[model samples]
Target: MIDRKKIALLICERLLMEQEMLRVNYINTRDSIGFFYIDNLLPVAIATAIAESFPTSSEMKLKKSLKEDKYISAQMDKHSEILEEVLYAFQDPQVVNLIAEICELQDIYPDEKLYAGGLSLMEKNQFLSPHLDNSHDKERQRWRVLNLLYYVTPEWKIEYGGNLEVWPNGLKAPQVTIESKFNRLAVMATHNDSLHSVSKVLVDKNRCCVSNYYFSDEPLKSSDTFHVTSFRGWPQEKIKDLVLRTDNFLRQTLRKFFKKGIVENPHYYKKE
Candidate 1:
């Protein structure tokens, strides 16, 4: 069993401590992305144990098109018992309450479907392109509002790559990249403007982190116009960007009629 209360207190302490750290807010009114740096988020002992449990894989499987780039999704239902416990620790009422308090979210709930959850591992040359997440939940009953990413790569340095990048002003400008520090959690609002991606894992080591998305009845913003989760490429990946944009157009267009996009995004849990 996970001690949700202790984890929540720890998170609150970190948030208060980080009030003085560098805070990055979305540049334009376009994106709702924000970054708060948390140091030593998970206890050293717990982080080390979790790191040891990470499977040593030469390569990742099941590449899914997110935005214009490809990613490895974590299937919550299939996770090991320990991993599931650690992941659920983030969903505790206290932890959720702290996140809501820090990000100022209203009526937040854990999406058991986990639209996109699990460990995202990127090795040398592997990269994720900038893109917005789908705006609605799996069933389209609730709206996707926040993205929660917790990094547990111990002793990982900036040179290792796998930094979190936020392109608040669309693809034309330089993106703000934040190091995926160990035992740190990055929570940001996900709206039509929340354009984000993971930089290519530059070093030989694998960059791994746990992820979860939260949903609510209310959208992130009242005036946040309805649009599909859009994606764009780096200034160099022109061809890839064009293809991805077209793909997004088709999905969003279908969403207008289907409400749940063209095909159901099975990023979450499925019934047996």
Candidate 2:
């Protein structure tokens, strides 16, 4: 069972009460990177249940590459009942609309198919390089607008790493660190220049999060342009950075000329 009633009750009680305040704060600080987080997003008991139910890193698919080491899976049927319920709770239409109001976006819709939105598990040494998400869905119809991240790992701390870093002024300036605090929810706009990444995890334990993205008919910025999921290494990784830059340019060029590309992206859930 999805247990949406329970999820809805908690969200309505905890998050809906602060919608207007969050809207003002989100608008006031949205010019660059544009994000805000709410701690203790759900009751501690529910959050603990979700965290305890998360599949181990070994159970999820290891997306090992230069960009990240996290385990990600969109196949909800394969996970525990509570995991699916909590993941989709963010997808609830009312919840989606409320978040849209907070982020000041219109006609935004949650991705029920879970394309690039699902469970994420990171363990020791896992990290995600700074990068801009793909500007659109797998089919390029709707513009990917907002990234909704709900961290559920219990007792997670700032020092544990895996914190989200946003580069509002590009990579040269110091980044803003948003700790992946347990039971916290982060909403950040995703567009042409929303460069962000997760710092490497230092502890041996696993960090888990439920992620979802909202899409719209129009791009966030009128000047937004289409692009592939671009990546760059840490500031000190001079050579890797250069290589990734070249790689990004090539991918962008390919995407511009070939819209959907020769082969489809394999990241989406292939429901049977």
Per TM-score, the best of the predicted structures is 2
Q: What tens-digit string does per-residue lDDT give for candidate 2 at 1-272?
A: 43966796677567777877888878876787788888888889888889888988767888988877889988888889898888778888878878887787779988878888899999999999999998998778999999999999888999999999999898888999999999999999999889999999999988888998989999999989888889999888889899999999988888777889767876666878
lDDT of each: 0.69, 0.87
Per candidate, the number of residue pairs that clash is 2, 0
Off by over 4 Å in 1: 1-9, 16-32, 58-60, 64-73
Candidate 1 lDDT over residue span 100-169, tens digit each: 6666556898776566676667667777778788777767677787788888788888778788888767
Q: After superposition, how far is residue 251 of candidate 2 from its true place, in Å?
A: 1.5
Per-model TM values vs. the true structure: 0.85, 0.96
User: What is the lDDT for 62 in model 1?
Assistant: 47
Q: Give me the overall lDDT of model 2.
A: 0.87
